[model samples]
Structure formats: structure tokens, C-alpha cells
Target chain A: MDILESIKVALEGIWVNKLRSALTMLGIIIGVAAVIAVVTIGQGGRAAILSSLESMGTNLFVVYPSSRNATTPITRQDLITLEDVEAIKNIVPTVKAVAPTSYLSIMTQVGRQKEKTTIICTGQDYKSIRNLELVEGRYFTSEENNSRRRVAVINEELAKTYFSGESALGKQVYLMNTPFIVIGVVKNDPSNALGFGGDPPKEATIPFHTGETLFRNLRIQIEGQTYSKEEVQETIDQIVKLLHKRHRNEGKYRGYSLDQEVATANKILGIIALIIGSIAGISLLVGGIGVMNIMLVSVTERTREIGIRMALGARRRDILVQFLIEAVVICLVGGTIGTILGTGGALAVALIAKWPPLITPGTIFIAFFFSASIGIFFGIYPANKAAKLDPIEALRYE
Target chain B: MIKISNLTKVYRTGAISVTALKGINLEVAKGSMVAIMGPSGSGKSTMMNILGCLDRATSGSYIIDGVDVSTLQEKELAKIRNHKIGFVFQTFNLLPRLTALKNVELPMIYAGIPSKERRERALKALDKVGLADRIHHRPNELSGGQRQRVAIARALVNNPAIILADEPTGNLDTRSGEEIMDIFQQLNQEEGVTIIIVTHEREIADHTRRIVHFRDGVIIKDEEVLTPISARTTLAALPPAGEV
Candidate 1:
């Protein structure tokens, strides 16, 4: 019989035993669904991280103090201060902006509400360096940062929590019992940071010099933005060397861009996704075995039918093709359903996790073809068994 | 036309042997109707199986329409079965899932006929068997007589060289049996189709023009009926269908 006729016959057989066929296909459905969802979610996460990294600016670099040996402790002289920031701004022409930041996690109070918030003390250049967006009011000026003004810029989360109904601008937010006027409300950029479970903590920004009196033994984080990506490593080298020259310590400072870290993380993520996706594929193998088992049962059940077809002049190849087509139809149908469900599941997860769902056509194509191949691989034994039956004995079968 | 010379079939199971057909010689002319009748273990079924190309003979030169089928491989045997022979089983053997029309189209499907032509020829064959109105009914939905007629349509749709019926009316009532015989006789007389019937019932065998009796795997008697009983006359004499 022709392929079309064989497919029709297969479909008819499946239709007659709809419940049995569906039960047999359950394994494949789960297998394909898991593979698709896991792979898609993994890709989506990687894409989100990469996009966030790009949003942070590829030319941006961070320089922090690092003790080369465990035996040597970092002294106050090695800390990044206004002088080092000045030297980088004046000496490094490649550097666009140099912003020094200090982080202090402390309790803050606004009206009757009290919450723990990370206060980031930095210069006005931090707005451009970190690519932060101010939704309301303006950032504090350089004069305010240099004169130790107690003005602060709060993230959207803090503004929403403490000042939900009213504007946060010009509000008195007390940090460690010291009052700082809210100068601006910056939009919360989740991509700015990674690996925060559930929701990130509330954050507020204050002037750089204003944190000196409040913080002791402060380890400052220096952020620099360059005009282009090509000058990032050279500019980092220049700043690190400048710090080393002033501190009289060769390896007292470390500098790197986010691009290198992102690449390494991407490689690791890809490997991890592959490993997890392959683990999911083991179920597909089991599903293939289930298909084979059902096909075997089907062949035995239809022995009489095979005999009748043979008597009607069906070649052995025709019988084989008929059963093989039935097996493939089951798997392909299951695979199509699984693909849709998996993509939908991945989208649901992406919605909750706040990331885009990334599913490629190639992944779907491979999945479909893989399922069909499973059918063929698992179908051969049963089909061959049916094809080789003695027409006499088969006709005699009850 | 078929010619069998020294046809023999041996069955071996774990050193035990049983010869189903032993040195049997038979000849059947084209467009002739014949019946092979015997008791159980008389080898009539074995002869029918060999003649239908459903089984290979152990030792014989069985020729059908100038082709030496005894030495043919399974593939060539299948081709001959598809093109030159049709079979009607005692149980009807129609695919339960198929309607009468689709069942009739089965042989033609194996013959690689196109769908449109297969449908047209299947309709014609069903009409010839007087089952055109019941073509949409499945086998279970059909009466015993109607189901037999559908089987006949399926056997005839491919227009093979010979139509083989093994106990064609074994499961039917007297009236349905006679009606089935009437269609066979009509087809044989009008279209000159070669037909072979395997039946143990003497009454059924009387409707054919020739009878071959088998005993102990051998043909004991082969004779031509001087005045063959016409199934049409028998069916007409019986009570009208659905009254008995």
C-alpha cells in the first residue's frame, strides 16, 4: 500500500483505540514537555542575563581593593577616596566618568514606617556610569556630593513602600537617625544586579562625602565608564597602576569589565542547561520503549488482520510500513502536543520570573524529528515480527 | 487455468510428521466452477490453501495461468495472489472497522489501484453482488447473507483469474446459503469467471458443475455433474427471505 493509505490505516487504528493510544503516548508527552520547558527556560535565563549585562554598558569597569596575600590586610591607606577618584579623572583621558560608591545596609525610617535598605553613597557621575534612570526629581549636584550634603536618591521600590500615595521628593528619610532629604526617585533596574531570590532589598543613594562620617574602615567601590569597548582593558590597567603607584603596593587593587565575566557565566550556563536538558531526555528514551511495547502488543493483537491483508496480496513491506506508520503517528502527535504545552509552560514560568521566553525553531524541529526517529527505532522489531508471520498460522489465529 | 502435478504438502513438528496432501493431481479450466468436498483431515482445506497461494506445496509443479507458482518466492507469490486470485473465508474475514465499500476496495488497494478507480470498481462489484445499498454498513451491521455478499464483492473487485471460497456458506442459514450459491452461479455463468468452492456439505457441492472428493490426503473421486443443480432455482423454491 502507498504511504498515504498506510497513514490512513494507522490513524483509523489509533482512533478505534483512542484511550489505549493516549495512554501509550503519555510517556512521550511528558518527556518532550520536560525537555522543551527546561531548555527554553535555560535559554531564556541566559538571554535575560546577557541583555541585562549589555544594559549595564560593555565599556563599564569596576575597580576595588584586593589584598594579594591572606597574610596582608588592607589598610585605610589602600582604600579608594576622593584623591584616587580625582587622579583617575585627571590622568586617565580614556575614562569618561569616575564614580566611587560605598554600600551600607542599615535601618531607615520614613514617618512611622521602618525598613532595612542598602544605602549606596556615590558621586553625581554614578547616574551616567550605572545608566540609572531618574523618574522624578534630579540627582544631587557635584557641589552637594563634595560638600557632604545629606541628600539622597531612593529606588522605586523604596519610594513605593514608604511613600505610596504621595511624592517622595523633598521627604525626610532618616538613615541611622540622621535625616537626608529625598532628592530623586530612580527606577529600579533589576538587571543591574543578579542572583536575588524573590525580591531585592530596598536601596537608597546618598552623596559620596556624606558617607565618610557615617562609615568607618570603608571599602569603596570605584566605577568607571569609557567611550568605547576597545579602551576598557587599557583604561583599567591605567587606573589600577595609578592606584598601585600611590599605595606602594603592587597587587593592592583589581579592575575588570563585566564583558569577560558575562562570557564565562554564559559558557557555564550553557553547559549547565545542556546537562539538565539531557537528564530530561532520559524520559524520552523510556517513552520510546513504551511505544515499542505498545506496538508489540498491537502486532500480536492484529495478527489475524495481517493475515487477511496478506491474503489480499499485501507484501511484507506493506505490512511493516503500516505498523511503522502507526507508531510514528502516535509519537508525532504526542510530540506536537508536548511542544505546545512545553512552550506554554515556559512562557508561564517566564511571566512569573520576569524574563522573556526564548524558544528557537531549531529546538522544535529537532524535537519533532527526534520523536519520529524514536518511533522508527522502537517500531522496527514489532513491524518485522508482523511482516514475517506465516499467513496460514495467522489466518488460523483467533 | 491451473495445473497441479504430484502436489504434496508435509507438516513437521518436533520429529512428528503429517502429510496433508500426498501425490494429488488436479486440473481446472478457465471459466469453470468446481467444488472440492471432504470430511475433516481429508486434505480438502490443504488443497484449497495451496491453490489460493496461501501455502507452498512440499513437492509439486503447480502452474496458474502459465506461471510456475510452486517455485516462486514469497514476494512473487504475493504478487500472483494480488493479481490472479481472490479469497472468501468462512468467517467473512472482513475488517470489522471498515464499511462494506472499503472492505470491497481492499484487494484493489493492494493491487496499487488509484483511489478514485478503486472506489468506482468497488461500487460496481458491490452492485454486482446486489449489495450496493448496504455498502456503507459495517460487517457487524450487516445480516449474514448481506455480509457474505459484501465478501463476494471484495473477492471480485480485483477481477482476479480465480475466486476461491472456503466454506463460503458454512455460517449461513439454508436460505442465505442458497442465496450465496445463486450469486456464485450467476457470476460463473454470466461472466465465465473461474471459481473454486471448498465445502464439506454435499448439498452445497451439488450446485457446482464439477466435484472432487478427497480421502487420506488423496483425491478419491473426480467427476463432472451431468445435470448441475442451479442455486437460483433452489433459492426461488425456498421460502422468501426473512420468512424462515
Candidate 2:
């Protein structure tokens, strides 16, 4: 029979028993919907994580002091110096900028507003080393850093807390009861990349020398160690060698690179994304099985129809094509509906919950192609069954 | 023309073998109306099925219009059924979902006729059966006589070499059955289409010009009926072989 007529007949068969056909399609619908929803969510999560990492500045490297003994804590002596930062830049061609940051937990009072936030002390190059957007005023100059002038750049949250609708730049804020002038107000960093999760921590930055003098007392049992800016490379080399020599008593500190740790963080995020995507892929498999099950039932129900077509001059290939077309139609319909629903769900979540839910064209293509292949893969047995039916016996069937 | 010699059909049901047609020998001339009359289990339906190329004989030499049909493959046999024979079952076998017109057009669709031409031919066949106005009526909407008439139109739509009816009137009333027989007689006389009816009723057999009696898978009698003058004139006016 002509393909159009066969399609008409198949459609009529489906329409004749609307409830059964709809119930059968439900399996496909659920399967497609599950696949779309899971994939969309997974993709959104991956984007969120990558974006969060990106906000930390792609060019910056984080260094942490390692110890062989878990109980041994890294102290102020283990802190990276400006000289070490310059040495890394000079020695490593790929190192564009280096900012050694030290954090102190302190109570800061802006007028009557008081909040506890992390105050990071770093060099004049810290602003350039990180992709920190300044919303007001300007970063502290190198001259101010050399003079050990007390100046700070407050984060958006801290600025709002201290200034309360007023611009915080050029205003005095007290850190640990020590007065400091705010030179700049940094823009709010994205809570997380891709907008999948909660907001990140609040922080502020100040000139390195100012931070050390205000937060540290010279009366402590430690010798004052000062290195010139030009000797930063030698200072970093000496620090590495000294640490290695001192830790020669232990094996854990060997072969450790701060840059390697940052790179490993990115790698971990990538692996997490892959694992999430793979977990979502399990739904596609279930959808394929659903197609197979429904197709098997359809073939059994249409046995006599297959027999009649064969007896009426249809070839085995014709029967195969007919049944395969029906299977594909079911999946294509389900896939299209699922794609729409998935995209809508993503958009809704993004809009209503203020979460970033990305729906990329690539994701749609993947979902569609995967669903179509599922149809073909599951349709084979049913098509073969229809094609291989004995015409005489089928005709004799009640 | 058709020829069958030493036809045997043995069906295996598990370990036991049942002979449906045993050494049957029969010949049917072109343009002749014939009936195969017998009681149930006399193998008349089996012979009809074999004649229509819907089944294969275990052993036989059966030729139709110079082609040996008994040795053809399943696909080739389907081709024969599509182009050389049309079947009318007692059940009507009208797909319940399709209209009368579509039912008649089905065979031509398998023959790969284009839609426009298939519709035209199907309408003409329905017109011949006097159900042209009911083309869009589904089988359930149609009366028993109208449904059987639609089947007749379907059987005639392909213009095959032979029309094979297996108890065509078995489901119809006496009046509807007579009406169907009249249409068959008209097709045989005016269209010069060869007709074969498998029936157990003598009244149904009496309408045909020839009868082939089967008993227990064998032909017991073959006899010719005397045709009326008008029927002879109608047959004479029909187009010759290959013209219709």
C-alpha cells in the first residue's frame, strides 16, 4: 500500500482506541520529560559552578602552605611575601600578576553600622591580579602602599552595611578600632557562576602594609623580616628552598605548586559536571526501554493488520517501514513536547527563583537526536516481528 | 483460463497432518461463472483460497493465464492476488474504520495506482454496484446488503482476471443474498469477469452457469448450466481479453 494510506490506517488504529494509545504515549512522554528536565538541570548546575570559579579571576593562583603533620598549622612566617610574588612573575613566563593575600577576621564599624567580615590585606597589584570590578572611586595607589597609608576597598555588601545608601568611598571606616579611609567600593561579585546556588562570602581589601601594622603588633616574639620589591624572585626562591629544607624532615611538602591546586579545582568542577550529566543520561535509557515495551505491545495488537497487508501485496520491507515510521512518530512527538516543557521549566525556575537556568541549542539537539535514536533502537524488534508474520496464519487469526 | 492437476494441501497441526485438499483436479474457462458446492469440511474454502493465491498447495500444477502460480514465491503470489484475482469473504472484511470508497480503493492502492485514478476507478466500481451515493458511508452505517455490495465493488475495482467469493452471502438475508447473486451474475455476463463462488446452498449455486462439486478434498462433479438468451447476448457484447 501507499505510505500515506498506511499512515492513515495506523492513525485510524490509534484513534480507534484513544485511551490505550494515549496511555502508551505516556511512557514516552514521561521518559522524554525526565531526560529533558534532568539534562537541563545538570547543564544549569555546571554553568553555575564554572561561572563561580570564573568570578575568582582566571589569571589568579591561590597558594596554601602544606604541612606533613595534620596538627601543624601554617603561621604568619609561612605567608608569601611581595618579593616571592615578584619572583614567581619573573621566573614563570605564564604568571601575569601575583597578589599574596592574608585574611583577618575583625569587627568593622562604618558610622553606627557594625558587621563582621573578612578583611584581606594584599599588595597594590592585587586589584589588577583579580578581575575585581570597582563600582566607585579608585583602588589604592602603589605610593599609598609604600607609605603604609591606611586605605581600604569595601565590598558592595560591606559598603551598603556601613554607608547605608550613601557612597562609602572617601569615607572613614574603623577596622579593629583603627581608622581607615575607604578608597573604593567594589561591585558585588556574582554569588556563583551560572547562578545555580547561594551567594558567596562578603570580603574587603586594604593595603598590605596598613593591614599588617593595624592587625599585628611588633612586640610579638618574631623578628621583623623585610624584603625589597626587586628581590621578590630571590625571596620566593629562598622561601621555597627554606620550606623544602625545613620540611626535608617530612615528605608531604615536596612537589607542591599553588598553580597546580587552582588548576585541580577547575578539573574537579569539570568532573563534577560530567558525573551530573551521566546521571541524567540514565533517564534516556529508561525512555528507550519504554519505547521498546510499547512497540512490542503494538505489534502484537496489530498482528492481523500486518497479515492483511502482507496478503494484499505488501513486502517484508514495507511492513518494516510502516511499523518503524509509527515508532518514530511517537518518539518525535514526545521529544518535541518534552523539549518545550523542559525549556519552559528552566525559564520558569530562572525567572521565579532568580537562578540561572541555561537552555542551550546544543542541549536541544542532544535531546532530540538521543530520543530519535531511542525510537530506532527500540523499534527494530517490533518491526521485525511485523515483517516476519506468517500471512496465512495471520489471515486465519480471529 | 485456469488449470489445476493433482492438487494436494496437507496442514500440519503439531504431529498430526490434516489433508485439506486431496488430489483435486479442476479447470475453469475464461469468462465463465462457476460455483464450488459442498458441505462443511469438504475443502471447498481451501480450494477457493488456493485458487485466489492466498494459500499454497503441497503438491499441484496450477496455471492461470499461462503463469504457473503453484511454484511462485510469497511475494510473487501476493502480486498475483493483487493483479490477477479479487476476493470476497462472507465476513465482508471491510475495515470498519474506512469508508466504502476507501474499502474499494484498497486493492488498487496495493497496485500502486495514483490517488486520483484510484478514486475514479473506485467510484466507477461503486457505481456499478449501485452504491455510488454511499461512497463515504462506513461499513457500520451501511446496511448488510450495502456492505456486501461494497465488497463486490472492491472485488471488481482491481479488474482482476477472476473474482473468488467464499460464501459471500453467508451473512446476508435471503433477499440481500439474491441481490448479491444478481450483481455477481451481472458482473459475469456484462463485464465478462470470471466468477467462482464457494457455497453450500443449492439456491446460491443455481445462479451460476457452471458448478464444480467437491467432497472430501476431491472434485465429484463438474456440470454446465443452460444460459438464457439474454445472458448469452450480454456476454457476447463484453470486451475481449486485454480490452477491458
* Candidate number of the best TM-score: 1
Q: Candidate 2, residues A15-50: lDDT per residue as tens digits?
A: 776776576566666666666766666566555555
lDDT of each: 0.90, 0.73
DockQ for candidate 1: 0.69
- What is candidate 1's lDDT per residue for A65-86, written digit by digit as tens? 9886324778887887778888
Q: In lDDT terms, which candidate is top?
A: 1
* Clash pairs detected, candidate 1: none
RMSD of 1: 3.1
Docking class of 1: medium
User: Per-residue lDDT of B1-244 in model 2, one digit per residue for the tens?
Assistant: 8999999999998999999999988888999989899988999878887898878899988999889998898778888988888878887878777899988988887888988999999999999999989999999999888999998888888788899898999998766776788788888878799999999987778788888888898888887777522333443565442310
Candidate 2 CAPRI-style tier: acceptable
